[model samples]
Target: MQWIENGDLSFLDNRGMNGFLEYEKAVREIIAKVRVNGDKALLSYTKQFDHVDLETLHADSEHIATAYRDLPGTFIEVIKEAAGNIRSFHEKQKPDSWDVTHADGSRLGQRVTPLDAVGVYVPGGTAAYPSSVLMGAIPALVAGVKRIVLVSPPQKNGEISDGVLAAANEIGIKEIYQVGGAQAIAALAYGTETIKPVDKIVGPGNIYVTAAKKEVFGTVAIDSLAGPSEIVILADDSANPDWLAADLLSQAEHDPLSMAILVTTSKSLGKAVESHIQKQVRSLPRAEIAKKSLDDFGKIILVEDYDDGIKTVNKLAPEHLEIVVTNPEQILPEVRHAGAIFIGAYSSEPVGDYFAGPNHIIPTNRTARYSSPLSVESFVKRSSIIQYSFEAMQNNGRKIAEFARYEGLEAHARAIEKRIQE
Candidate 1:
């Protein structure tokens, strides 16, 4: 980890996205083939890319049942607990339809409605993310989405991850397909023979999947263009240097591009954290990846005071933020950006990633400035509700027509004028 003082911090901006342009041609072709060939393209791509031949595309009850039989009871219990937490948090976020009536008898409001269907892409092949299944599916279910579909790549045994299946089963999601990558994304956007099309798609994947999501965004709503994971810790002399080092490594181990940084008022604490990270990186299982991430993106930034630290962290607007100062309450309100905020020493980034009720699928690459963490809101759509009484239209009709004509939209003017009482 490198140490720097609070001067020109523009070097840490991280403006560029992952190598997206490199994959655009490939992704466009994959989407085109899936749209034209449907199930044939999905099956052929599965066999070609995943190197596994599957007899069927859909996962039946037997698949989930086998997962329960094989998985450890303790792991199942933990998954249930995590799922409950995620569900409870999102349920609080559920939106209700509301309307307000004006004095002129005009009713205007928003009618909140869930999408007809949603697709959750869980990455499979090298790793099984049971956690992702819970994060991505539970919110849509809480939002009242009627259909929830799960897609993941099959492994060498021609089966999806048991852990993933177990998570899906926990969430009451039965519609799952054994397919992944850009082709699977296409299938989710446009229906195949085996899989029904979803109105929206949510979850994270490799660069190819990310590229596919970018391509299919207009065809179907997507969660966000997620970038590499990142974290910014605003700490002081109060924060334990050892714990801070371990926390930084949490994001670092995720990928070679993942960024971890410490913004602190105390120079001594920054140095200590940097030293601890060097020592900790050697012992981790993903040492090679963590080492590369730390070498490239990790930093220990020194600030003049608490105000200075907060200002710098706000500009970064990292995906995950932790405030471990002597008085976190004082700093919490000042934070204008960050996908998720962990307030104290106990509230580590991983705690939110796993057990905590908050969704771990947060905006990365400084997107938190405008975007937000994946939540119940991500699964629902809002339709503007308008009901103008004759009296209301009589009052505003001519003005609206005049305004429409100003924009040179005569048809729009006539539509309103037709409703107005002479």
Candidate 2:
């Protein structure tokens, strides 16, 4: 891992920080093709990327039922438990439609409505993340979205993961497709012959998936253009070096591009953590990927004081911020930007990612400064409600007309005038 002093080096300025660009262009081309050609384009891309020859892209009820039966009882129980927690957390975030009536008998308020349909994309290359299905689908479910469509790449044998299917079934998601990558995003954004387009798309994916979401954002809503997983640990000398090293490695093992950094005021602590990482990473199966991530994007910045360490963390705006300092709450106020904050030594990033109930689909690559974690709000829309009584319109008609005329909208002013005359 790279070592630097807080005042001398700015960690966020590193050139290796940006998301991979080469894969983005490929995804854009795929999106355009799918948008124009629809199902034909989807079939071609599915064959080329997923290497699955499919008679039909959609997963039928029978397929889903079989998946449910195939999954072990213990895993199914775990999914249900996790889904309950996720649903409970998001249920609190549900917004209500409300109206207020004035003395003049005019009513005005906001109407909260669930999105008609939503498409969730789950990555299928390395492994099946049943937890992701629960995390992504529960929010839409809690918000009362009518239709939930799931899209994931098929395995080499042209089958969807049993766990993915089980989770979808548990959440009452009926429409699922054996599709993945940029093409899956395109199919969801623009309907194919078999698959219907959705109002929004949510979940994490590779660069191709991220770029496809970015391209189709205007046409369809998206959760976020999430990048690789990342974590930043804000620690002091009091933190356990072994725990600190393990936390950093957890994120590092996510992807080759995933970043993990430790910002501390203790040089001795930094050295100890580095030593611990060297010992800990060797036994892991993903050591090569973790090693590359740590070698390139990872760093340990030794600061003169705690304030300096906090300042650097804010600038980096990592996806996951873990405060393992003496008093985690003391530095909590200093953290201005972060997707999620894991306070104290016990609160690890994985806890939030899996069982802690908060959405783990966080903003990455410095996007935490602007974007936020996925929630019930992402699955609903707010429409302004306006009802004006004749008396109320008559009272305010002149002001309304004047405002419309000031904007050079004669028709708008006349419309209000005509209503007032009535």
Candidate 3:
């Protein structure tokens, strides 16, 4: 890890937005082929890119059932517990249709409705993440989304991972596709012969998949233009070095570009944490990936005081922020932006990632400054409900006409005038 006694935070301004522009040309071609050729194009790309040849793309009930049964009883129990937690959290977020009546008897309110269908993309190949399926699909289920289609890349043997399939079956998601990457996104946005288009797509993927989502956004809603995973730690003398190092490595192992930063008031604690990271990383299975991430994006900034650490962190606007100072809550009020805040040393990043019930599908690459984590809101649509009573219109029609006239909208003014004349 590189240490800076006192460094400018500008270097962290835009982390993951630059390199994907070059992949746009290739991503566009993939989308066009899928749009024109339908399932034929989808199958061809699946075989070519994923190196898996298949006569069929869909995973039927028998296949999913087999996958679910194949898992150990212990693993299944843990998944069930985690699902319960997630469902309970998102159930609270479900909104109801409500209306308010004004003194003039004018009723105006909001009607919240779930989208008809949603597509969830799960990354495949070297890694298999059952947790991701739970994080993305459970909220859609709670939002009452009627159809949930899951797309994942098949392995060299032309089979989806059992873990992913188990998670999907756990949530009662039956429409599963064994295709992934840009073509899968295209098929979801613009329906193929077998696969149907959806209202919105949510999940994480590589650059090609992200670019495809960006291109097809207007055609179908997307959660966000997600980038690499990231986390930032704000620690003081009270923080534990071993725990801090473990937390930082959890995010760093995600990708080579994933960021792990530390802003501390004590210089000695920073050095101790750095030593612990080096020792801990040596034993990790993905040590090579974590090592590259640390060398490229990892940082340790030693600030003069706690106030200085908080000020610098707001500028970073990390996806996950861990406040491990003397009193973590005291610093939370000053934290302006972050996708998720893990308070104190006990509240680690993985707790939220898996069993804690909060969605792990968080905005990355400094987008936490504006965007938010995925939730029930991502799967639902809201509409304004307005019904003006006769008396209310009669009382305000002239004022409404004059305001319309001020805007030079003659038709709008005349419409109000006609209503008033009635």
Candidate 4:
């Protein structure tokens, strides 16, 4: 990991813009083929990439039921617990349809409506992420989405992971398809013979999946162009190097492209954490990936002071920001950008990722600057409601017509005029 001192913001370029641009042409071509050819394109891509032959693209009810029976009781219990926490957190985020009336007998408010159907893409390759199932599906369920469809690649035996299916079953998601990659995204965006199109798609996936989501965005609503998982540790001298190293390694294990950064005012603390990382990473199962991630994308920046470190963290805008300082609460108010902020050493990133009430599907590659963690709001839409009585229309309709005419929209003005005249 590179160590930087002084104020240089260029190190904040974690997501290489050039790398994404290089793959854009290929991803766009895949999206275009999927859109034009539909199911044919999906089958071809699935066979070529996933090495799985499929006569039917959708998973049958029997397969889903079998998954439930196959999964262990302990795992099912854990899923239930996680689901409960996720549900509780998102329930609070659910916006209410509210209306307010003025004395002029005019009613104006907002109506919150859930999307008709939503598709969630779960990645299935090296790992089966049941946490993702809970994170993505619970929000849609809480938003009152009627149809929740899930799509994931099947193994050589033509079966989804038992844990994934169990999570889906727990959430009451019956419609699941045995598909993956950019092709699955395309199928979700444009309905196929077997798979139906959806109002929105959410979940994290590989670079190709992210690129495909970006390409098919206008055709169907998507959560965000999720990049690699990342975590930034803002530690002080008071932080334990062992705990800091463990937290950083936790995120790095997610992907070889994932980033783990440490910003500290104390040079000794930085070096101590670096040594600790070397020792701790040796025992991890995904140590190879974590090592590569740290070698390539990770950093240990030595800021001049705590304020400079905080400023650097804001500019980086990491997906998961951890404040392993003496007083985490004191510094939390200053953090302007971060998908989720973990305060103190006890509140590790994994806690938020799995058991915590907050959603873990966070914005990556500095997207936390503008984007937010997935919530119930992502599954619902709000429509502005307006009702005007005769008295109210007579009083304000002329002003409305004049404003519309000011914008050179004569038809809009005339429409309002006709309503008032009646």
Candidate 5:
């Protein structure tokens, strides 16, 4: 990877969402078909896209049990540990409800309630991520979501990945379905004969799944329009090139479209990291995908100082940010946006991606500028509470009616007038 000086950082501002526009027409048709045909469309699409013929839309107890039996005990133990960490972290994020009473006996507050149901989508093709299951579902469970449904595409043998099923089982999630892509998103948003609509859908998927979520957003809440995974490292001479290179490859291996960028003050470090990346990627199982990603989207920027590097990193707002500077804490305060920040050489990005308890379902494609990682808050809704005493209403009703009248709405004024009269 050749380093560029003061390179154009404008790519971070664009989400690359336009790439999905071509899929929108087909995705919309799928959504419409699912809405009308329900289970039939889901089954047909499963066969068409995933090449799986499903007699049942959901995994039964026997299948789940078999999955558990088939998975290695060590994998089971690790998932349990990760789930515990995720649950503990999200438990701290659970919000409480409280009311404030005014002297006039007017009360106002917010009632934070868990959504009734939630759907988690786990991507499945050749790769099996039990990790996504834990990261996506544990937060909803922490938030007290009653019904947690998990959906993943089936293999050619009409079976969800055993690792995925094992993770879901480990989390005590029973509502597992063998459907995926845009069709799975549609079913999650709109109820089918077999699958009930969920209050929210949270997880990562392919472009078609992302487009489907964008389409059904208002019909049901979605976590975010997650784009390809990405990471940016802000480093100095103190940073280790080998570690930085490994961390960059982590995100690059996710997809060919994923981005791995480095902004640093050390030119030598940049060259060394690029050399390490080339050496390390050759050994990865997904070497082809990682190499393609690096060729297409990978970048290295040489900045004059930490100030310039920090400015560029904030502007890019990469999903996963690593601060491998001399004093990461000092540099951390300046970071305005990023899905998650890893500090120091020891705190590798994969630690948070798997076990450090923060949700790995983070905002990608510069969405870190506004969006946040999935958490308990994503699984709950807040309703405003307002109760005014008769005396308080009598004192304020006329004022409200006057304001409504100024806006030229007679009915709005009359409603306040009626309350005042009473």
Candidate 6:
């Protein structure tokens, strides 16, 4: 970690990975091939990219049953518990269709409707996140999406992860496909003989998968063009240096591009945390990856006070923000931007990543300043409900016509005027 005593927050800017556009041409070709050849292309891509020849593109109930039998009892129980927590949290985000009648005798409201179907692209290979399965699927289920499909790359033995299958089974996700990458995205956007098209796609993936989602965006809605994992910790002298080091390393080990930053008022604390990071990282299995991440993107800025620290954080708008101070509540309201806020030392970022009720899928690369974490709202669409009664139309139709005519939309004006009393 590079410690800057002067606190230059200008280095706070992160890399913008716009749905991994660098892979656009290749992703487009993959989509086109899937469109033309369907299941054949999926099989070919799976063999070519995943390095596995799949006999079938489906993970059946037998496969799920095997997953349960193979896994330990403790892991299975944990998955079940985590799924319950996720489901409970998202269920609260469900929006009811509301109606209101005004004095004009006109009904104006909003109707929330869940998408017909959704596809969750779970990344395989180096990143097999069963937690992402719960994070993505449970919200869709809460939104009342009728059909939820799971697509992930099969491993060397032509099977998805036992943990992944277990998570899906816990949530009652029926459609599980042994497909992934740009090809899986193509299969989801455009229907195949075995896998039907979906209304939206969610979950994180590599450059190719993200690029494929970008290309097929209008064809099907996507959660977001999420970038790499990241975290920012704002702490005072009250925070434990050892705990701080562990928290920063947690995100650093995720990817080479992942960032970990700390802003503090105590210069001595910064030095201590930096030392702890070095000591802790040596023992990590992904030490090389974490070392590279910390070497490149890790930072420690010593500010004069929390005000300057928070100002810098607002500009950064990190995916995860941890505020560890004497009184965390006093500092929280100043946080204008962040995907998720972890208040106090005890509130580690990883809690939300797995067992916690909040969704772990967050906006990265400063997007949290504008966007939000995935929720039940992402799975449902809202329609404006407008019903103008005869009396109401007579009273206000002229105003509506005038508003349209102001924009020089003659047809729009005439349409409203057609029902006017005058």
lDDT of 4 by residue, 222-294 (tens): 9998888889999999999999999999999989989899999889999999999999999999999999999
Work out the TM-score per prediction.
Answer: 0.95, 0.94, 0.98, 0.95, 0.97, 0.96
Residue 156 shift from truth in candidate 3, angstroms: 2.5
Clashing pairs in 4: none
lDDT scores of the candidates, listed in order: 0.91, 0.88, 0.91, 0.88, 0.91, 0.90
Looking at candidate 6, what is the lDDT of residue 407? 94
- Model 1 agreement with the true structure over 344-413: per-residue lDDT tens digits: 9999899999888999899988889999999999988899999989899999999999999999999999
**What are the per-residue Cα lDDT tens digits for candidate 6 across 253-322?**
9988899998899989999999999999999999999999999999998888989988878988999999
Number of the top TM-score candidate: 3
Off by over 4 Å in 4: 14-18, 419-422
Report the lDDT tens digits of candidate 5 across residue range 1-422: 54578567665554568788789999999999999999999999999998878898978789899989888888888988988999999999999999999999999999999999999999996778889999999999999989999999988778988889999999899999999999999999998999999989989999999999999999999999998999899999999899999999998998998999989998899999999999999999999999998998899999988888888888888889999999888889999989999999998999998998999999887778898999899988899999998889999999999999999998999988888855
TM-score: model 1 vs. ground truth: 0.95
Mind giving the per-residue lDDT tens digits that candidate 2 earns over 1-422?
99987365555555332554777778778888987898888878889987888888887678789989988899888888888888999999999999999999899999999999999998896688878898889999999998998999988878788889999999888888989999999899999898899999999998888888888988999998787788999889889999999999999998888889899988999999999999999999999999999998888988888788888888888899999988888889889999999999899889998888999998887888898999999999999999999889999999999999999999999999998865
| Better-scoring candidate (TM-score), 3 or 4 | 3
Per-residue lDDT of 226 in model 4:
84
lDDT value for model 4: 0.88
Compose the digit string of candidate 3's lDDT tens values, residues 155-219.
77678888899999888888999999999999999998999999899999999999999999999
Q: How much is 14 displaced in model 4, in angstroms?
A: 5.3
